[model samples]
Target: MDRWVGKTAVVTGASSGIGSGIAVGFANAGINVIGLARRTEPIEVLKSQVTGSGSITAHHCDVSSAEDVAATFKWINETFGCVHILVNNAGIFVTGGITDAGDDMISENDIIAILDTNLKGTILCARHAIASMRSNNFDGHVININSIAGHYVPMSSKFNVYTSSKYGVTGFTAGLLNELADHKNKIKVTSVSPGLVNTSLNVVAATTTDMPALRPKDIADACLYVLSTPPTVNINELTITPVTERRL
Candidate 1:
C-alpha cells in the first residue's frame, strides 16, 4: 500500500526494538522516515534495512532533552517540508518496587527520570509536531507507544516507575484525543498499549515471568493499522498482548 507515499514520518527511539520496527514499516509503505535516537550506529543499521523505495534519515537526538528535540524537528521540517506522522516511542523501563529487594527500591530520582523521559519527552515531541503540523495545515497523526501496564499494573510489586509513566502516557493520549475532537481538528491521536514485547527494554530484567512475549513488529503492525484508517475513523486505543499471557 502506497498510502504513505510522499508523506514524512518522525519516529523516536528508532535505533532498536519497536521504534525500529515502526520505522521499517513506514518505510516499506513508501513514507519518508526520519528516525531519532541517542545512538547513531544502530539507527544507521536500521536505515540500511529499509526497503530502499522510501527515504530514511537517522538523526541522533536524546528525546529526554527539549533542546535536542526542537533542533531535530527543525532539521526534519527543513528537509522534509512537513511531517505527517509522529511516533513517540522513545522510553526507558526502570524496574523497581515501592519497597524491597537489592537495588529494587524505587528512588525519587528514578521516578523523576521516568517522568522526564517518558511523559515529558512525549509532550515535548507532540508539542513540536503539532506546531509544525498546524502551521503547515498538515493533517497528521500522533501515535504514542504505551503499555498494558498503563491500564492494569500486573505484578504491581515490581516496576512501579515504569507503570506510572506508562499510565501517564495513556492519560495524556486520551485527553489529547478529546481536545483534538473538540477543536474539530484533522490531526489523529491514538495510543497503543502492548504487553511484554520481546525487546531490549525487558531483556535484562526479570520483572515479567511470562514467556512467549509479543514481538516488536506486533506493535508496529498496530501502529500501521491506526495510520491506515480513514480520517473520519479514530482508533482511540489498541492493546496487543500475548494470548497466553494472563498477566497482561
Candidate 2:
C-alpha cells in the first residue's frame, strides 16, 4: 500500500457492485484511481463521496468496445502518464441456456454480448494497460475479477454462456502469465475467483440462500491483500468461497 501511494490504478465496471468496492478500497489506500464504466453517473457520485489522500476520476467506457477502451486509455495516459495497476472487473449476465430451443434459447446477440464483455473486454483492457506499463518501464499488476464458474461450471442451468466466458478468463489469465514469464516481464497477473457474492451479479442466489454468501467488500479485501504482496511474488489464482458454499 505504501509503495502504491500517489500511483495510478484503473478499475473497470466501477459504477457498481464489486468494481465499485475495489475502486473505493484502492483509493482509500492512497492510490489515484481511474474508474471506468458504461454508466458514469454512479462513478461520478462516488468521486464526490470518496474521502482519503487519493481520489477517483470517473471515465465513461464500454469495455466491449475497442474504440471506447482505446480512447479511455489514451485519456488516462494523457492525464496520469502510467498505469501501475489494472482491475478487469466488468461483466454481465442474461438468462438463457445453451440447449434451449425457440423462444427459450439464448439469442445470438446475447451470446456475443457475454463473450465480448466478459472475455474480449478483459483482453482489450489488459492489452492496453500492459502497453502503458511497458512504455513507461513500470512494473505493473493486473487482477482479473473472475468467478468460481471460471474454474468449474455449477450445476445450475441459468448460467448458459456466462460460464463459458468465465472459463475463457481462466485460460486467458494463465496464457498471459506464461507470455509475461517468457519475456521476463516484471508485470504480475492474478485471478481472484470468488463463490456466490452478494452483488447484483448474484442477487437471486443471495436472497434465496440461507447459507453464507460473500459481499462486494469481501472481494475488495481479497484483492487488496493480493496487491499488497511483494513485487517478486505473484499470486497465480485465489478462489474464495463462503463457508456454506457447496461448490468445489
Candidate 3:
C-alpha cells in the first residue's frame, strides 16, 4: 500500500537490524525516511538499497542521550518540514544473571545505562515528536519496539535490566496511548513486542542454545501494517514470535 506516499518518517537505530528494515520498508512504500543512529555507515548502505526514488536522510545521533535526540529531531523537523511517523527502535541488550554474573554482567551501571537508553531515550524521542506534531498541527504516531521479555519472564539467562526497561517501554506506550486518545483520532501510540529476533543485540557468545528467531524484516512488516491502518484504527499492541517456541 502507498499509505506512506509523500509522508515523512523518522526511524531510530536505523543503522541496522529492525531499524534499517523499517527505514527501507518505508522508503519502498514511497515515504521519505529519516534514518537516525550513532553510526552513519549502515544508514548509507540502507539508503542505497531503497527501491524507489523516495529519499533517505541519515543522521548521526545517540538515542540514549537527550541532547543528541533533541538536536536530531530539530534537524529532522527543519529538514523534512513534518514528521508523520516515528519508530522508536533504538535499544541495547546486556544479559546476565543478577547474582552470578561478574561486573560486566548487568551491573548497577549497566542497569542505569539500559534504562537510560531504552526507557528514557524512548521518552525523549516521543516528547520531541509530540511537541513537533502539536506545533505543526499534524497528527502522527509513536511506535516503540518492545520485546516478549517485557511481558513474560524468560526461561533463559538473566536479563534484569533489559526486562525492566522493556516493561517500562510497554507501560509508557500504554500511558501515551491513553493520553493521545483524548485527541479524538489525531495522535496514536503503540508498542510491538517480538520474541528472539536474530540481531546483534542477542549476544550469541553469552547465550546458550540457538533457537528459531524472527528476522528484522518481520518486525518491519508489522510496523508498516500498523502505519498503513486508517487514523480511526489504533493497534495498541502487537507481539511477533516464532511458532516453534512454545512459550507465548
User: Highest TM-score among the candidates is held by which one?
Assistant: 2
N/CA/C clash count, model 1:
0
The deviation in Å at residue 187 for candidate 1 is 0.5
Where model 1 places Cα greater than 4 Å from the true spot, the runs are 99-103, 203-210
Q: Which portions of model 3 miss their true places by more than 4 Å?
A: 1-3, 100-104, 183-185, 204-210
RMSD to the hidden true structure, all candidates: 2.0, 1.5, 2.1
Model 2 residue runs over 4 Å out of place are 101-103, 203-207
TM-score of each candidate structure, all chains considered together:
0.92, 0.96, 0.92
The CA-based lDDT of model 1 is what?
0.84
lDDT of candidate 3? 0.83
In Å, residue 183's CA in model 2 sits off its true spot by 0.7
Q: Weakest 10 consecutive residues, lDDT, candidate 1?
A: 203-212
lDDT of 3 by residue, 1-248 (tens): 46568788889889988899888888887888888888988899887788875778888989888889888889888887888888999898876656654554557777777888899999999999888888888878889999988888766655667888999999999888877777664787889999878788866422546567888889988988888789688899999987786672
Cα lDDT of all candidates, in order?
0.84, 0.90, 0.83
Residue range 74-184, candidate 2, lDDT tens digits: 999998999999999999988766765535678899999999999999999999999999999999999999999998888777788999999999999999999999999
Native-structure RMSD, model 2: 1.5
